[model samples]
Target: MQACQVEQLLADYGTEIYRYCRRLAGFGPDGEDLYQQTFLRLLEADLEPDEGRSPRALLYSVATGLWRNESRKRSRRAAIARPVELDGDDPPPLAGGEEPEAEALKAAENRALAAAVERLPDKYRAAVLLAYGAELPLEEVARIEKLPKGTVKSRLHKARLLLKKEMEARGYGREEL
Candidate 1:
């Protein structure tokens, strides 16, 4: 692809791709690095846009692969490094016009949900993040995951059940999730 085409792709899909990376990497510096590296890989590959493939899907596929590879490396390093506990920051205060209490409650629920998702096994986490968090259709998710559509659906179903149970255990009603 030409430089102009890459610029267009970044304009069109960059935010969604970055958001997906953040969620996939649990929202940290690692996510920011992954987001940068996704576009870099795209540029390096110099791929012509295929009529059958959406650029958004291609960006996501790249991000997912990069994250998986980095995760594997991190795991190997983790085996030798001393683990450190890190505290998560509290959610920002609600802006004007909304009820503060209600906003705070919603934030708490969201944090709980995110925590539950982070706790999920990697396979289930990837399926859930791609399908719901990134708002990708099952077919596209399957294509990116290189899994059968039925297998992706099954994984999504199982992920939803696990998330529901986790939220319930955290004192959230099913409706809230």
Candidate 2:
């Protein structure tokens, strides 16, 4: 792809891709690094845009693959290096007309949900992040995951059940989620 075309793709999908990275890798420096690496890979691939494909899906696939590879490396490193845990800070409250208490509650719920997601198994987590975090259609998610559409749907259904159970354990009612 030409530089101009890559620039346009970044301008269009960058935010969505970054958001997906953040959700997949957690809201930390690792997420930031993954976001940059995703774009870098895209630049390196120099792929011609395909008429049948969505650029956004391609970005998500790249980001997912990168994250999975990095995660494996991290796992191996953890066996040698001293393990360190990094906790992401809560996002700032939304600026709106809503009451402060309501905003605080919403933020708490979001944090709980994020924590729950972090605890999910890799397969389920990927399905959740790609399908919902990136807002991709089920068909696209299946294509990216290289699974049948029904399998993707099944994974999503199972993921939702796990998340619901987790959220309830965190004191969030189903209605709140």
The reply for model 2, stretches above 4 Å from the true place, is: 79-102, 174-177
Weakest 10 consecutive residues, lDDT, candidate 2? 90-99
Candidate 1 regions exceeding 4 Å error are 87-101, 174-177
How do all models score by TM-score?
0.84, 0.82
RMSD in order of candidates: 4.7, 5.0
Error of 2 at 171 (Å): 1.6
Over 1-177, each residue of candidate 2 has an lDDT whose tens digit, in order, gives 677877898999988888888888878998899999988887788866568999887888888889989989988999899697786643443434654687778777788788788888878899999887877899889877878999989988998999899777665674532
Count of backbone collisions within predicted model 1: 0
Query: Model 1: C-alpha RMSD to truth?
Result: 4.7
lDDT of 1 at 146: 86
Best TM-score among the predictions, by candidate number: 1
* Candidate 1 lDDT trough over 10 residues, lowest sum: 90-99
lDDT of each: 0.84, 0.82
